[model samples]
Target: MTNVKRKAIMVSLIRKMKEKGSWTGETHIQKCTYFLEEFLRVPLNFNFILYKHGPFSFDLRDELTALRADNFIEMEPRRPFGASFMPGKVAEVLETKYSNDIDKHKEQINFIVEKLANKSVKELERVATALYVKKNEDVSKDDMVGQIRELKPHISKELAKQAVEELNDYIKEAEHNHIIL
Candidate 1:
């Protein structure tokens, strides 16, 4: 898809996430976009790596900055946490123009947003890291938990195991719904 359409989708995602009561911080968007691309197989083309919080994409960061500049999204500061993202002035226009593109992936978007919108950043980190390990390394579920702990020593073994199990359920659900091939 074209860059404009992708930007529209990003805006739509931000809007949907906000509607679903997500914090809509950059971290939230990053993780949700990671699942949208990696788990749901959307061709968003953001190159992710296991970073400080979890799967992160500097490219997506830059795109977000550009979206802000173009008035496709705006950031609002929230006390005690950080700034959150919201749809900007022209966001609706872009969404309307690219509604078809967004519609094509709406089911996947809804699935991920529903599963993840209410999660805390720390939870996102653990689960996304679990997915990263599962996808990048050839390991069993138990071994993936070990890798998660190795990568994120801050997480407890029990939490790591739970994250891995949650990721497994997400994968199974995505597969059963044909969200992933």
Candidate 2:
């Protein structure tokens, strides 16, 4: 799109976001980001960003970067969104993705978070165990059997079984204890 057209789209997005804090529709968001990167290049600031088709808003910079990927927003060199109004569960995983520790696991964690949001801690443990099984498949058949074998002394099957049963509970307990760190 031409610069003028991009500007027009950005202006339109700005008007919508100003009125309701977001714009919805695939073409709108993609085109909006296609322009926003340029608009933002001027060091100008706005309270809202047109995140996507989800009328969501965020209040951070890094978060904007994740949501503004090439496929998602068509922006380059990236910009962190200043605010988000995504649903809480969706927002949480997005926040965690920008977090330092497990940043790389954002996508997987987001999917799990979505699935786990509706479940009890009891259910989460079942899920975690199931996921562990799938993720660990072929440790004996894949390439990690030797390492697993070497670590077997430190990792007992019995202990792991117990852990599978108690994982969700433990995560909850740790959270209750203020131990997420």
Candidate 3:
């Protein structure tokens, strides 16, 4: 996949983990990645999403299965979530919400350290992406909101709504793909 696509999926998955505070399974990662590419305009790695971070209370496999059964998510590889959802109006004024507002969003994501665990470092990287975007102006509110609404059918209305806000945070956090490390 193109670097742009890969980064897009990474941003979406990370936003999901932060918004929900956790996620599980290869499929959920796959599902999130698929929609992410469409909405965020990026591609993803399912294996990267599955790589374990640490022992955690939540079981990724079980959560993925349950979420799928509940119709809250889908696992399609290349398909975007269905069309029942639309990102609502952008908040009247954008403001910092999650993660302590670090002088830099990267600083905040790095703060995510090992207290809680998800399946991958990519997840951490994704959160970093949101932080990067929130702090930068590369992504507009309209673009971010459009991406969140794309998840409407597969993810819940409430979840999608929340995701929109989370996307804003994620976009705020996303760094330029070519920034020198």
Q: Cα lDDT of all candidates, in order?
A: 0.93, 0.33, 0.35
Instruction: Please rank every candidate by lDDT, starting with the best.
Output: 1, 3, 2
Q: What CA root-mean-square deviation does each model show from the true structure? A: 0.8, 18.7, 16.8
Cα lDDT of model 1 by residue, 50-97, tens digit? 898989999999999999999999999998889899999989999998
> Cα lDDT of model 3 overall?
0.35
lDDT of 3 by residue, 2-25 (tens): 433333223333444445444424
Relative to the true structure, candidate 1 reaches a TM of 0.98
For candidate 2, write residues 1-23 as lDDT tens digits: 33323333333343343234332
Q: What is the lDDT of candidate 1?
A: 0.93
Number of the top TM-score candidate: 1
